[model samples]
Target: MTAQRDMKEKNPWHMSGMVALAVIGVIALVTLVAVMVIQNMPLAQKYKYGIVLDAGSSHTTVFIYEWPAEKDNNTGRAEQKHSCDVKGPGISSYVGTPWKAGQTLRECMRQAEDNIPEKRRAETPLYLGATAGMRLLHMKNSSASEEVFRAVSDTLQTFPFSYQGARILSGQEEGAYGWVTVNYLDNRLKQGLRTTGALDLGGASTQISFVPQALDGGGSPGNSVTFRLYGNDYNLYTHSFLCYGKDQALRMALAHHTQSGPMAIKDPCFHPGYAATKAYSDLYDSPCVSDRKPQGAPESFLHTGIGNFQQCQDVVRTLFNFSQCKYSRCSFNGVYQPPLQGHFGAFSAYYYTMSFFNLTDTSIPLDTVKETIARFCATPWQQVKQENPGTKLKYLVEYCFAGAYLITLLTDGYNFTAETYADIKFIHKIKGSDAGWTLGYMLNLTNMIPAEAPDTPPLPYSGYVTIVTVTVFLLLALLLLVGRTFRPSCFKRSLII
Candidate 1:
């Protein structure tokens, strides 16, 4: 009995050990269940998505891309690509009365939902980002502006899943993001030819970006690009000069003329090259008396013929150089300082330069050029809508212009310029109305495959990303340091493995 009692005492800790084991088992089971629940949730439901509602000076585009899907640990399948759409009128320069931009978005979403399967329709996420239109809406007296934005936000909140925020992407970021999406999807501009530059021309603004290739060493060179965007992503370390668009430039020129007391002399320093000058001349230069009558003349003289590729090149160079021009006015005195250039010439100069100067010398076969322009010009909305379903054709064309410009600028070794001028044949073939992905056309134009540039280094001045990162990091660090005083247990809890 004594020996039995001693044995029982020796095994006394067994109960405590069993209790500990049970507690640990329950904890592990709960953790596994929680993870399973999270994993099973659809990506749109679990992850936050962003919306870039670009309300331009003349138009608006609401771009919503499904957030990159996360790889599921348990199932081992990648998340699926998701898409959403919404739109509003360009409110950037709107005046007089507020329009139904918000209602337009609601209508667009409703249309999109109508097209989706009922089951899948409820699974998707949505967001709205307003741009120039909103900025101009608030302008000097923002009381009304704030109210409009608040109204937009409130209306957006009515949806099951939606976010409404001001989208003030910097010029550089706008260019960079566009480029990133292009290259990420198409893989253009790889290795030595990876250096890229872009110019986006709009009614009220122009934007440019320069992306350099990766060096043999894995670091990016400190090069900068200048373009247009309002002051949204200033932190992205870009230069956005406002009132520098073509119309703005023209307006500026006229304004400067008025400011300089009339009959201002032309400054030869800041001159547009042949193509750009011609474009400007076509628009503003007086017609020759020898060519046509004063009032009833054909408008052809007023319209600059579509610029050839070489003409575009010359214009681009002129524009870039013109920005540095020092105008000297021939004042009654020997000469006065020439007035500064404005957005009209400057803005046009940028597009001409980007399209011509930056591109490789591949002659777009005259046939191809004619066909492309004709098809593009004649492409009906119904056909495109039937094929691409919900995309805007104008946006795709603009994207193509940017892509073509980038490809030409970067791939100089291709002898495309010389060949283009001499023997390249243009073919106008529209394969289908569904060709909404402009990358395909752009890639074929340059004979580049989209898989070539998977890991190329991004440009140095990627707009607000750098600033946003630093700000977020600083805020996180401060929170950590301060929170330790009030909730030291929080820190200890975080440290627990």
Candidate 2:
């Protein structure tokens, strides 16, 4: 009996290894079957489409995606998408012709086709968008801008693949889209954090967007949006002040500084004796001598040889008055004089600072926003200043932050507030991977180059009152600081004397 019991125990131990092997074998078999099924699935059945396009001031991009399909009957979202960039001039940039802009998209599509497998390519959908470059086409030659748009549209229609309508995203849509893309990619955009805001500084404008919670618990999945056109989308309340951009600001400054009259036509003292006349003075600061008889040497004084500088100034001034009139009186034609301070630079900086606060969803201190913008613009401004100390700089440093303009335009035009913006959140940033610069970095990470829309000569200027209001507050603060510091010093000196 004892021998029989021992035999039974040994038999159980013997089967243990076999049982383990059997389980593993079953698992392996199941995995192989699943792989085969996946391989056999149709491309459309296995993927979802997702795409994003960033049409910037300098370049445009077309992105397409095909996500992996889910197993079982349940559907799966699209896999990570492919990004293709068209390298050419932006449609709205004040440079390049229309043909160049259209070529950008075509090149991008060709590159994308090369990257995608022939078998799977048919399933992908393309998405296109145009940003500030297209918006600011008027800054350049108008005919070129139209051609650029037409080319892009025509190319999209001709492509064999399906094309979604190109999104000429509102400033708010741009902000929201960016927010969604980032957050969706990164897990950080969740729950409470979903209600966040973003600032997108482009070449010509800035955009700000925030998410808002639903009024009722049963509200829809997508968040509500608001937008404005002036300046940028950030500071809706102060959107008016930021309306003048880098180019516009330059024109205004030049206009106020120029001395108009027959003197404008006369050649001033040319440095290196290039041209004595104002019209021939070098804007880029060359050392060419004037054509004056006997070779008059260039003068070492400001405004001495810049004959063209005066004309540029006059034109700029005229434009500024025109812009100001549209802004202040809402009149297409109104009589006005330029400000006497010749401090458009200071005013521009100060106004932008205030607008930063105005654009943000939070009630953060104005100085903090000012500091951020100042830092962003300071680098380039410093370069300009260092490169040419003798010449006057055209743009204020802070005004260069196109993202601020986009933010403000979206915020004010859309009526997007902190509460509304809080719905969107930024997740993670993809660096060295923006598919927008495919022509070997020909297109850097540039934002929109704002241009006027087709048939729109000049968008009605608005928001002068905000600039004036902000300026007055700044003046008061300056006067107070001066009174506190200088008066005390002056009193002490007088008493001692």
Candidate 3:
């Protein structure tokens, strides 16, 4: 009995010894779990930055964007942090003195420099994309355009940010990027949602882009662009009409009106009190008006406002040639387009004119817009200025004409009927970011647009925690139960043997 008692006592599975073994096992299991938790914890977030400069015809703007480092290709990771509009006209306007183009960018570049952190300044990419104004300038005088590029490039090179090339963006590129911008900002591209069509109106051009319902319905391959984004293929139809923007269109319409001779041109689009004189050379300079320009003898035409919406619509309607089309369907001027699918976003001048004329809200019918334009056109030009104090007088006086032209363009040129008109939403900005092509351009150049979704765990974070917690406890319980059942009497016997 004494030997048996000693044997029992010697065993490590004695009650107190079992309790101690259990405490050690718990500590070891806890240590293992703590190590795994440390391994799974997410690292601290780090952010990176980038910059893009939109040197548009009417104005120039600098856009600064940032994204987190770990999520380089994630949708919505990059967002606009700041944007600065360069003072005075666009870089293309500095044609006569090309060096001044570089000088014009300094103010905005300073703002960009101030906004970016010192460490990131060197790594951030800076890009300048000149649009239609430069395109026209390049067509008219290649040397002047080259000089302008040289000037802007020199200035950009001086900045600490990485300077990507500065040059003209093809109209197709402009339209594609504009489409990408709208869809990206809408979060559609990333989320695999149906995309909105983009209609961008600049000073010298207008572009329409959308993913067609029938991918092959788009008329020509040249007018279409294909992109694989987030594991989905997008076949987009895009076309940019040169000299179709409000500013250039106005120039062409005025030229068409004065073909009768340069005396006291009565323009129905302008308010009754408005009068402006445009030189013949100035009108002739545009490709839209070159053919209609009078024989070398004419000086200038005096334009007087008549303020008639019906007449204005008539004039604007003549600007588009609806008669000619090779495709089963065309928007205008033989440009092929599928029946527009989904909603449309009209930005730039579209938003400006619509907002100024109280047509920004949805459900604004064609007749409703026409009625507003007629009333606003009748308002004396002076009263118009007073209502929109400090507004650029040029744009203010032209609002009546712009409103009429916008209505005519949509109804006649694009065939957006009153029934479907509500789908056309005019927006200048999306989530504080200007709805323009520059952001999308930058996103593409930096490879931020991923072709596939990033790999993610099948289970969610909560599922992981619950699974691990339950699994660890179950495993530890099994080990404890086995230890309790096996009894340490074997250890005491082994010592004797």
Candidate 4:
């Protein structure tokens, strides 16, 4: 009997042993199921793409953006994948020869085709948003603008992407979207953090947008734009000044100095020793200065430079009309603007011009910034060229004027004081995306940014897996303990015998 009892205990199929085996089988099953679930879950990421063509005043840029296929409505998911600058000027430049504008986009569109995956190409939405340049063209010649649009539309339709219509973005939209781009990339919208202002200085226009502490009831209602994003409401103050862009502003300044129709005039904005013959017709071609053309003006005039920063600022300030304001307050030209608020991101030409002079760092005192620009402006034209070898002559010569104009625009036109000037950060890009309206424009059109926060899993995939694995092991240990403690009656009786 003793030998039989010992044999039963030694038998692996005895009740306790059987129970332990069962527990192990359960563990194996649970582990296998867990792994299968995890593996079957969408472990690999797939992406969707979007294409936005930023048709600006100076040039056109193609921006390709991508986001996770499943998380389109999530914040910060969309990012700039690739960008191509369409060679030549903006489409508005092809007023008479509109077909050439369409041709200009072909190379860039082909590049877009190469960058986006074939699978995603068909579904990818393509959009073209023209800014100030087109607006000006439309005002000057509506028929020519329409033709340009039609031509651009025809060219875009040829691509496999889902071509959305091309149209001009209003100044308000331009300013607001630029604000969105800056704040979105900063992740401020998602987290419900304080927002940053956006200052976009384009070739044909400039935009200022920000959220003020309070909206004055007496302020101009036209300047206000409200949006509900991520369960938060934002009241934005945005304005785009027409004919206030760097290039346009330059024309205005030159127009101011050449009112007498002189054969030669010395411009304070340009570096000393600079001389260029500019046609009166070319200068007066734009609607900004067309009315100001001197009657019976010479065909061309000799333009010379004196390199005076203070005088250049005085010249630039003449363009702004601070004389009248129907509203509670004004920035310039009687345009209503609330008190400046929060940090500001200066982009596009603001970044480019400041980057050229190494004045992008806002930490540098306002006086120091002025001193630096003054020094550059005072530099002789030949010396400037020699210092920047291989640089385009047209752009290089204009930097002094551009620099003086920027400082004056900020301080005099926008009313940014020396203390407040430090709040401005000259940024061309934030994270990987360009700090412009294109991404924001895309996000708005696609509904990629949800009005409310998106639902998310309680734990990350890895954390959940670890917890599940640990829980399974713990359950198995408890099951084994129970199995050992409560043996079957038959087994107990056998042991007793």
Candidate 5:
């Protein structure tokens, strides 16, 4: 009877049953934790895309932007994926042969098609926004502008993407959207940081946009733009001066010098020894200087260079009419302007021209910049060409003029003084995206940037995962400790037997 009782106490089945329960319980707990984690885990990441074509005065650029499919409304989430520069002048140049404008986009469209996934192409939105060049073309010939747009639209529609019709963005729209692009890329809009001003210098126009420290309700109504972005209200002072772009301004300067139809004119803007015969008709073709064209002018004129920086600046200043203003303040040409505020981003031609001169660094004193440009202008044309052999003669010869014009436009026209010059940042791109209006245009059209801030998860994914893992480990350890504490005496006896 004593042996039977001891055997009952030391039953191996009981010990084994207890051990089995602990193991099963641990397995079940682990399985349940894994199931919870697996169910909550994010799936493979997928992306959605948007395309914007920046059809500026000088050229056309196709920008491909993409964002996570699940987080389309998130601020600063959309980034530039790829960009292709169309190989031709802007679509406005194709007015006489509008069909050719459509052809210019083929290669770039093909590149965009290849870059975006086939499945997403159908839903991907594609938009084309023409800037100042088309504005000028539209002003000159509305019929031609319509034809060019029709041709461009027809070509864009042929692509698999969701084609939004091509249209000319207003001067105000151009400036405002450009401001949006700069601020958005910098993550300033969502954070409500002091906004940066935008200065876009294109071929046919220049835009200046900023939020003044003191709101001037008394200024010209046409110059003001208001926006509600990321729950922040912004009253922007923006103006686009037509025919003030570097290229058009250059034309105006040349027109001033050639008033008498002189066959051989000395141009201080060009490098010494530089000479080119240009047609009078070509010079006076644009609306900017067409009225100023001297009657009975010769078929062509012998354009010659004298290379004088002071003279060049003097000539550039003539383009701006500082003679009269009806407002309390004026930038130029009788245009109303409020007081300048905050840091400014000077892009497009501003960046390119300054970059070419190695004067993009605003830290350099204004006087030093002028000195460097003056020295560059004084360099003989032959020596200039020899030093920069790889550069195209067309762009190479114009550096001197562009530099002088840039300085004059900022200081004399926009009233940026020597003390305030450092505030301007000459930038081509910001965080991989070109600093321009296209991204903002797309964002506005697609409603990608929500007016309100997006909701966020209580715990980050990594934090949740770590907590779950730690919890599971702690639970298993506790179970093991309990099993040891409550373990049957039969398990030890069975081992000894």
Candidate 6:
């Protein structure tokens, strides 16, 4: 009787505690599952659009990009949605009849218009950037360049979309934007990542750009370009080698090698079995040709391939002058370039040429590149054409020369040694967008490359959720403690009564 009385007086707190914990556990379990489900749900999405025109030397390509509207500040949301290649050549090709440049773009522009939604068309910005081809046009005949620019501009303005502008992009701008495109797409420009360098090889020019530590190469001030992105400052070293593009460089080689009285030209870069006759004037008319001989009626010359990769590299090497260095160190042609550091994104012709020989995906030794080039060069031109019948005949015929030229330019001209050769990543595209300067160009023009960090809430979504979860658990625990301490007294009285 004494033990029972003592137990009743002390109160049955254990039963209340057990019952309270059971209820709390059940409620907490349900709430946890519901919270996980809600938290895991994807955010609702909205999109915005942009369009860019890449006026390359050989062709014109139209790209349409889309990104989430609300997350414009988030890096790399923009993506290529559609691409249209103009039927005709680039605008620079219409220098003779400048107005025809506008007409050539009509088909592609129409495609862009049809692809975008009618409601979004008015707000979408359309930009056109002419690369090395236009740069050469501007240099040879500024008036002609302007007429072509104006013609393309007028045509773009006729469209329903907002015509931002049509202009020739400087080599520096090309290099910088190309770098920006790579880093942006690679997500290296995000909060804690380091940016990558960009190496762009075009038909008429090539560009090298990178962020350097203290401008390493004793380069000219003109070669340095400053950028402010995401609240970080970058001092970049860039150089655009005009007329060093594969096509013009080939022209330069032919001009240098042309004998005084040869109507048929023997090109060592081609397969030995290959032969062709190109108009002599077509080779001489370009500013890249050092030949200043008075012009005559267009004469044809035989273009045959000897298929010698080493010989081709020899010809390509003549384009660079390594002798003079006004600075402590210099790339060929007295141009200053910082040492090729970190990984590099080599796109455009770099990808085209490397991919042609299947050397792009893996990092191959320099000697292996040479061996592959040799084997490809040894392949008969007829076989190459037979293998890729549907490809543009021009690209098919020039891959051998392009391969040799690419390797030579990288190794000898840019000072990229065997150790750094593997750093080059020959990429055709990033996330379906062509690997080039167009996306970065659009980003800059549209003010999407921000110089400051975006304002964010004090607590992120995950943090808020975590805090709420912890607070809820703590409150449940406190309630259990209080209920267990006080409820037993009521139990004791009720049972006794």
- Find the candidate with the highest lDDT and give its number: 4
Whose TM-score is greatest here?
5
Candidate 3 per-residue lDDT, tens place, 1-497, comes to: 57668866665566776686578777767756775676576655556777888988899999999766544333336678999888889888898998888998899899999998898798787888989999988887899899999988988899898887897999999999999889888989888899999999889999999987774543477888887665667888888988898889988888778776666788888888888876777877866677887665367778788788889889998899988888878889888878878899999999988888778986867688778889988887778878889788877888887888888887788888888788999998898788989878866765643333344454577877776787677667858765665655666556666
Ranking by lDDT: 4, 5, 3, 6, 2, 1
lDDT of 1 by residue, 307-405 (tens): 233433333232222222222321111212122111111122333333332222234443454334334323443443465545554443232223333
Greater lDDT among 1 and 5 belongs to 5
> lDDT tens string, model 6, 129-202?
89999888887899999999999898889889877788788999999988888988887765648788999998
Count of clashing pairs, candidate 5: 0
Model 6 segments more than 4 A misplaced: 1-44, 71-76, 217-219, 259-261, 290-298, 448-497
- In Å, residue 98's CA in model 4 sits off its true spot by 1.2
Question: In candidate 2, what are the lDDT values of residues 185-274, reduced to their tens digit?
Answer: 332232223222344444444433333322121231222444221212321110111224343333233323342312332221111122
TM-score-better candidate, 3 vs 4: 4
Q: What is the descending TM-score order?
A: 5, 4, 3, 6, 2, 1
- Whole-model lDDT per candidate: 0.34, 0.38, 0.82, 0.88, 0.87, 0.80
Q: What is the TM-score of each candidate against the true structure?
A: 0.39, 0.42, 0.82, 0.84, 0.86, 0.79
* Cα-lDDT of candidate 6: 0.80
| Model 2 ranges off by over 4 Å | 1-45, 49-51, 70-85, 93-96, 138-146, 156-159, 188-194, 212-497
For model 1, the superposed segments whose C-alpha errors exceed 4 Å read 1-52, 64-68, 71-89, 93-95, 115-125, 132-141, 188-195, 213-239, 253-497
Worst 10 residues of 1 by lDDT: 337-346
Error of 2 at 119 (Å): 2.4
